[model samples]
Target chain A: MIALDDTDRAILRELTHDAGQGAGALGRVVGLSQPATWRRIKRLTEAGVIAGKRLDLDLEALGLGVTVFLGVKLALRGRTALGDVERALAAIPEVQTVEHVLGLYDYRLRVVARDIADFERILRRRIMTLPGVGEVEANVLLSEERLGGPIG
Target chain B: MLDDIDRRILRNLQGDPDLASADLATRVGTSSAVAWRRVQRMKDAGVIRATRADINWSALGYSVEVSLRITLEKTAANAFDEVMAERARSPRCWKSRRFWAVSICV
Candidate 1:
């Protein structure tokens, strides 16, 4: 594991807001020279603390106005078929998030669309088409107090 | 450069991004300059990443966030690589963190 000092923690907090900010500015805020800050950032990335950067977007702007979770059941049990189904699900545009789940269901998904009509379209046109799915149940999310980032 | 005062600053600042530098210093039991310096140092170290922005996505008329979890048939050829690629291009997922052959959507 990569050991981080207090200074490192501070750097993480700042970068979480805007990774695009310049190194010089970051160093200026933290009392390190630009070069030193650069080195530290490099180290953090290498250590997997920084992970990766993403371009966050608004769902409404993209015409995806609804969000829901899905629990999926598969009718077929073959590993090869399972793999094919996975690929098929991934190809669908409406799928936002997908995971192998625990509990009553075998898998879950987060999906989005402009409205219920649109969602139904995706369900019929795309989701249900996956080869091995036995059943898929969807639940619209209510509220999200938090998404990601540092949640202490 | 971060001392005890710096830790105090972090605790206060992370909890409240709007806390002014003066108020932040006061909370940390340090002079404004010391607080500023320590905060600067901590920032450089990449610990405290950024000032929090309370973005109301819904206020901007964004839809609720969708969450997804998917499983692949374990025996399919190159299925992992295929799903992984879709995970990369997915426009709807706000957060997609990879796990052991499984991905978490947020």
Candidate 2:
């Protein structure tokens, strides 16, 4: 657990806002010199707070237009079964995010596809065949309203 | 709308955003000017949004990630708006979707 000061937080915010910005530009926003800012960023990266940079892709532009959440329940619940399911999920590229939740569902999976027909094909072909898989409730996403931005 | 060269450039950038235009040009087998222009065009077209750093929240002592599935009251005129407005004020409300799932760490 790393304790971040205000300056550290500001630097993180600025970097996550746009890492492509030069050290000088980031320093100007975060109230540090270029060298200082670079050093802080290096330290943060080394400390594992800053994992790496990512190129956020436009999914629709990439032919992934439909998004759905699957509330999954497994017939057999155990460590091995859970591990197997997770490994299977990792193998499927269309599955974007997976969360093991504490609720009526065992897992919540976010998946993207070209459309409903494509989604149906993936669901029938891949998702359902996983070991110990039982019931899955599909929730189609209509509109997404992000309240707060990504964590810095 | 991206050509083969643009896709190649994007693939390289997706791997490492820190690559300079010269390095990118070398890797993509294009002139530095062309590499820079293509990147600028993608940015301008919003195909490439903000290039941002990835933070490991788990490493920062955020061990618990929660997913909340909520069903809102559709009868109220401004129910969703009010809820979102209230949530937008809190930093802890990292991500909220209007449709179904919400992932947060407490």
Candidate 3:
């Protein structure tokens, strides 16, 4: 496991809240100079502690107003088959998040769409045709609140 | 409506939000002040929710990840709230230290 100091954790926390605030701003929050802050961030990124930066765009603003969660049961349960299914699912633009979860299903999918018609099209034309896919269950998500970061 | 400039700015920032305003301006063919203003406007408009750091949890010795499926009893009043409150106290959840994105289905 990679070791993280208090300063490193503080920096991560600050970045988790707002990475858009560049190195200089992040430094001010973490009590480090801009160059020192940049160095630490660079080290973290290079060491694989900080994976990547992501832009959280509003889906409704982008015309995707519906959110659906899908539980997928596979006909063939194998590593290769599952990988192929996941890759195919990921290729769909509307498929926002895919998780190979435990418990009730083999895979869980989060999909966003413009409306019911658009979601139906995706389900029929794309999702159902994927290899090894069977017994797909859909749940319309009413709301989502992100309470924690991936790093935590 | 988002014009070409707004689209360009979003695209550039989405790829590398760490870019300085001047560099972003150069990429999108806009002045530094214009780039800054557009970014700020997008943030205020809620088009850009947040830029976040992605962490590799598995590399942090958290090799095991499990998703729990909890169903509240329909008969009990405030069962959902009670169950969630109980869950909130789980040490494994590390709610104080980490974040979890919770989705509610109605």
Candidate 4:
């Protein structure tokens, strides 16, 4: 693991808040010179600490108003079954994130749709038709609070 | 309120948030000025909230990731608010979402 100093941590915090900030602006925030800050940031990037920059899109504004967390249980348990289910899930656009977990459910999925009817259509036509799919439970997301990363 | 061009710009932005205006415009088949104006308009409309560094916590020694599904009791009126407030105060709780009657923490 890479050992990060206070300045490194501070820079990380600032970057997490706004990745679009130029190296010069970021240097000003963390009390470091532009070149020094740039070097450190470069080092961190090379070490894979800062993965990449991501745009936070507003789903509601994009007409994807409904967000559902689905807990899916597979009827069959095998390596091939898992792969098949995952591959099929990747083809469906509405299935945003698929997490294979060990608990009451085999997989947890984050799904988005225009509305309830659209979600139902995806559930009926897309999700249910996947291989080894069984008992499913869904929880619709009402609101979310982004607390950000562990840089405190 | 997004048209085909706006959607194209957003799609490109999602893949590469740091893409220069001229490059983004070229990718989306639009001029640099049009691309800049659309991005500004989206920002004003809150369509594009923020561009953030996606830090790999695992590389920073945070390897284990757990998802907690919490169910609050109906014994107190302020129980949900209190729990949510407490979660908001914690730095490790990166994201917390409230569903119908369940809270998921990640």
Ranking by lDDT: 4, 2, 3, 1
Error of 3 at B45 (Å): 1.4
TM-score to native of every candidate shown? 0.54, 0.81, 0.77, 0.91
Q: Provide the lDDT at A54 for model 3.
A: 86
lDDT of each: 0.64, 0.80, 0.78, 0.87
Ranking by DockQ, best first?
A: 4, 2, 3, 1
Interface RMSD values for all candidates: 15.7, 6.7, 6.7, 4.9
Whichever of 3 and 4 has more TM-score, that candidate is: 4
> Candidate 4's error at B70, in angstroms?
0.4
Q: Output the better candidate (1/4) by TM-score.
A: 4
Clashes of 2: 0
TM for candidate 3 is 0.77
Q: Model 1 — TM-score against the truth?
A: 0.54
Per-residue CA lDDT of candidate 3, range A1-152, in tens?
67888888889878777876878988888899999999998888888877789888888886788888888877667744666788899999889789998777788988899997998899889988776887787877665645444433
Candidate 1 chain A: minimum summed lDDT over ten consecutive residues — where?
A143-152
Interface RMSD of 2: 6.7
lDDT (Cα, tens digit) per residue for candidate 1, span B25-70: 8887778887777766766665655553332234323436544556
Tens-place lDDT per residue, model 1, A1-152, is: 56667777667756766665767998998889999999988887766666455433445543567786777887665553666776777778678667775566677877888897987788877877666777677776544432232221
- Model 2 spans > 4 angstroms off: A145-152, B3-12, B19-37, B100-106
Clashing pairs in 3: A148-B99, A148-B100, A149-B99
Using lDDT as the yardstick, the better of models 1 and 4 is 4
Each candidate's fnat, listed in order, reads 0.04, 0.65, 0.48, 0.79
| Candidate 1 global lDDT | 0.64
